[model samples]
Every structure is written in C-alpha cells, then in structure tokens.
Target: MYDVSNPHYMGDHTGTRKFRRVLLKLSGEALREPGSTDNISPPIVEDIAAQIKAAHQTGLEIAVVVGGGNFWRGVSASNKGMERATADYMGMLATVMNSLALQSMLEAMDVPTRVQSAIEMKNVAEPFIRRVATRHLELGRVVIFAAGTGNPFFSTDTTAALRASEVGADCVFKATKVDGIYCSDPNKNPDAVRFDTISFHDCLTKQLKVMDATAFSLCMENNMPIIVFSMNEPDNIRRALVGESMGTLVNASGKDA
Candidate 1:
C-alpha cells in the first residue's frame, strides 16, 4: 500500500496513510550501541530521528514514548542495591535525557519537536498537558513523552498505550530489538515461532512479553491495536506508518491473525 522507496511519499495506493496518527514506543536501550555503555548513541539516535522525519513529512502525526533502560533500568537498579521508588525516579530522569537528545536530532532534521515530561520540568520540557500535546500533534509537530506516567512503578510501555489512547491514535507501534512477538525469546531459541498477528486473549494465554501486563491490559481494555516490530531495520518506522506489514499486530479481535 505504500511506496517504500520514496521517503516523502505520504499515502498508499489509496492516496492516504493507513494510520494518520500513531504512537511510537522507543526504548532508551535501543539508542545505545552494541558493547557501548553510552546513554545515547549519536549515530543511532540521528538515524531514528531521520526515520521519524521521513514519516512526519508524510503528514502523519507522530508521538514517541521513550524508555530509560539505556541510562538506568529501574527494576535492575532495585535488584542490584537501591530503593525501588528512588531507582524508578532516577530512571525517569534518564528518560528526560534521552528525550532531549532525540528532540535535538529531530530539530536538526528540520522537524519541529517537543519534549513533554510528566514530572514537570519547566526548564527542559513542558508539563504533560493532554490538550497541548494533542494540539502539537495536530500541528504536525513530533511530541516526545518522557517520565513514564509520572509514577515510579509504571513503565514506558504503559505510557505509549496511555498517550495513544489520550491522543486518539489509530494504533501503537512498538519499536523493538526483535522483528515481532514470538512463542519464545527468538534470541535464545532458534526454533522460536514469530507471530504475524495475535489476539489479546491469546497473548495473555501464552504470556508473551511483548508488553508488560499492565500496559497490555490497558490497550486491550481500550481496544487499541499495537504493532510490535524491529527497529533494527532502517526506515521501519516510516514503513510501519505507511501500513506495510512488517510486524505482529496485537488486538482484541484476531481477524488479522
């Protein structure tokens, strides 16, 4: 349905985006390089920004919810030797840093971007205001949401689902290290089976870890569809926005399955 070769192409054969509005879930760990401890890899982040710019140029309203695992994984920190709440707050700050980095790169690509934090850092980003964020999206500006629901225990996956519902997004695109949800860890099991599509009930029955339980439940309750795809492929973000079948789709109805 999409012209995969042209970055500026917005619509499909039907002359319109299959999904005009989508929420992109980005993990901070995805920004780091192999064997590198850097919180934000310049080349990686810039490439992601370029992809986002390409999709943005097509008139799609894009919103990103970034995680903080590259800087600090809250759960890991708590396991190592820190208090749970304190570690999670630190992780929230890490997300802020990643958001700023992404904003800078996106702006350099001439894509107007805004970083909104739930924790309300007036200096670095605007406070998370639902109306203002939606307006930014309506104006074709990329909005980066950070701080993971402004709470300690929640995750960025929940943020993506929450923001997608809040902004009336058609679907949530989960940019992941793997190509799609599998019966088992693809990295570990060579025989793992990848799912092109799966119902929410099936996902829960299998206990697939595409998203945390809370996040998945929220999307299921709201009847939101989620596409989990690999970010390793260049321009995959733009491709997904244009409705290419590049990942496994999760929904309440298993029609796509």
Candidate 2:
C-alpha cells in the first residue's frame, strides 16, 4: 500500500551480499523534504523502513546512526553565539527523537528494531552497550544508535565511525544527498568530477570531504571502508546493501588514489 513502490523483495531466500555486516549513516535532513515545513516526512521514512526491511531480509546485520540536523544543529547554533555544550546536548536530544521515530517506523513494518541511546534514556531505549548491540545483530535485529558518542562537541558522523568499528561492521554506508565523492562541490562546480572510488590517503591529502576529519581519520586508522551514496533515488539503499556499486567506495589502501 505504499505510494512509492518498494524494491523487489530479496526476502530470506536471496543470495548473500558481499558485506554481511554494515552500518548505515542517515542524515536527519534526509527525513525532511528540501523546501517543505515538515521535519520528518511519513511517506519518505516509511519507504526507507520498507527498504531496510527488504535489506534485512537478505540476512545482513545492520546498524544505523542518524543525525539531528533536521531538528537542531549544534555547530550552527554555536556559531550564532549560544553555549557550545548546551547546543550540542540539545542536538543529541534531537537525535533521540529521530531514533525513536525511526524505531517506531521500522517496528511498524514488522522489522525487529532496537533503539540504543548513548545518553541512557532507559525509559525510551536501551543504553548503548557494544556487546548487547552486537548480540542484537546476531539475532537479526536492526540496531539504531542515537545521542552521538554520549558526549558534547562530537558529531553523529563520528558516532557512525565509532559504532561501526565497535560492532565489527564490514563497512559504513553513508546515505546522503550527493550520489558519490566529487572533486569539488557538484552544485557549485559544474565541471567537478565524480569518483567511483577513492583512497583514504587521497581523501585526506587532497582535502576531499567524505566526512568530518575526526570520523574520516577513525575509519582510515582502523582500515574501515565507507560507501557514500545518494538517498534521493529510491532503492539506492537496497542496491548498496546488495553491493551493486552505485557510490564512491573509500578504502584503506591507496590503490585507487
């Protein structure tokens, strides 16, 4: 009954993906429309949940780290003269809300989901415990990590890097507005080049922005791979999980550099 059609269901009967374990990083802005007033669109997230359900049925262990930009941006607020820590904590709370919303949507779709809060909001979600989260994955549960590293001055991008490592995920899939890594701002620079793959060393040395420096550094240091792809096109998430290669793959070896 979805207004938008779901991807062809892979179900429990499908072939294995190249990556058996993955961490998906979704931005808060992804849940909202570009010019609309709604902070979180029901149909959009429903479709996303449907995609995740299909992907999970493919037998991959999935973890999600969602940002709070749709609700609040701490750094942007801090630049406007508010106290930095207070602003960041507010941003964390916003992520909790987004996580609860996502958990509700996924569970509504009959996909077993858990919301693990880094801030310990026991009433709403389980506390973030690495072992417990890993066990949840082993049990075929979709784990949503919220509250961003349980500290101030950190970002959800950093949270994804840390959790992906802790959960022993094979890779991190960053679903965003842009389709892949570009040599320059695709919007501002019409002649910018899109890279199918890039090495972490080049991403750093050339100052290309796959993610925040801290997050990127962590992934590089740990030899973790990241796939950056667009979420605007339907089924991109499923394609990514299926390893169809629609995005830029950032790797540890500077082979592609």
Candidate 3:
C-alpha cells in the first residue's frame, strides 16, 4: 500500500497518477559510442545526465541500476575460460566506475546523487543499504545502484527488480535500444509486431525477452510494473518520468495476449 502522506509520494492511490518513484535500468553500452574505441563516451554520459537532471527537476524519485558491459562482461569472460566468480566481481567493479561517472555529471548539474555499490568500496561509494537508498530518494537525491546484487551469477536487471521492490518504487523503467517489446526481435524480423501494453504472463508465455528470466520473475512475483523504451531518443527519459506514454507497459493490469 502507498502512503499518500509520505513526502516522497508523487501520486495518489486512486489511479489519477502513476510512477511516483521509479528504478531506471541502463546498459553500459548506452554510454559507449558505436564504432568507437573508447569504452565510455563522455558526450553520451553527459547527454544522459542532462536528461536525468531534467527529470529530477520535476521532483521524481529516481534510482538507477546500470550494467557493466562496456568495461567487462563476466559471462563472456567466463565463456572464454576465466573463472565465473572472479569475472563477475570485476564486472561489478566496472559498474561502480559507470555509476561514479554518471554521479559526477549529475552533481555537476547540481542534481544531488548517491552511488551505493553492492560490493562495499568505502573509498568510492556507500554500501548498498535499502533504507538509506530509499531515504536518499525521499530527500530528492538520485540513487545509483551498482555491482549487480554483489553476486557472481546475477544481473543488473535483477538488481533493478530487487531494488525497486525493496524500495517500493512504482515501476522499473528499462532503457533499451528498441522502442518497446515486440513479438520478435525487430532487428531480425521485419514482420515483428509491437505491443503498447502486455501482461507479465503474456511476456512469459510468449517467451519475449523483456529481461533476464530471474529479473522478470522477480517483477512478476512482486507485481512491479516495467516500462521498456528507447533511450536513444532525446528527452525520452524526461518524457517517461513526466508520464508521457512512449513505450510498452508490462504489468499485472495489462491485457492478456
């Protein structure tokens, strides 16, 4: 149940609004420029920070879960003969780097932010504490969750789901290259159909790759809504925060396929 009296409450329980607080899931590749040698492009991160700043100005509580694919991919490394646990730990550290980069840019714009790493790194960030993270959101500080559950086999997607549920966020906004969920991969299938809204059960039954199985399962179990949209479009993050419908909605109330 949502408490209307909570200072962090941005919407009412009567369905007049949605998404008071949300978790944003971003891929490390989002910060990288295509065909560039650099792992992270400053210009791209700046753009993303600017968008986030714009949204934060609207008084939305934002938490971010970013992946570490740009610097390292544990699964890929493990596939290439590295130990899975070691590679994943390194991958977690890579997320911290991205988190710090985003935090620096946001602070430069005067947006209060905090990075909480699942893996304790006292020199750089606060350890992941659910209450502290939620308090940061209530205080209008953007919280960036790094380190992917601090585990070897989990993903940042699962982190988003877990943190969103733990913090009682309204939804999880998944930023991706595609506009929304489709019947098939739009890149490979020209005849793919996009759904404006789809039920969690439908996504599962159809085997749509909205997120990793663990992440999707977590959301489904928690009744957490997810919005999947393209982050490539300018001001899309701001638009999404302000409740402009531009992506597919995956939730319990969605129509069954």
Runs in model 3 with CA error above 4 Å?
1-17
Best by lDDT: 3
Tens digit per residue, CA lDDT, model 2, 1-257 = 10101122222323222667889999999888789989998888888888888989988889999999999999999999999999999999999988888899999989999999999877999999999999999999999999999899999999999999899888889998999999999989999999877877788887887698888899988778888999889899988876665678787653332
- What TM-score would you give candidate 1 relative to the actual structure? 0.92
- Model 3 CA RMSD to the hidden true structure, in angstroms: 3.7
Question: Residue-wise lDDT of candidate 3 within 1-257, one digit each (tens)?
Answer: 22222234344444323467888999999999998989899999999999988888887889999999999999999999999999999999999999999999999999999999999989999999999998999999999999989999998899999999999998888999999999999999999999987877888888998698788889989888888999878888778766666678787757422
Clashes of 3: 0
Question: Candidate 2, 103: how far from true, in Å?
Answer: 0.8
Higher-ranked by lDDT: 1 or 3: 3
Residue 8's lDDT within candidate 3 is 40
Over 1-257, each residue of candidate 1 has an lDDT whose tens digit, in order, gives 42312223244465333677889999989889989877779999999999888888888889999999888888999999999999999999999999999999999999999999999889899999999999999999999998989998888999998998898887889999899999999889999999877877888888999899888888888888888999888788778776777788787775431
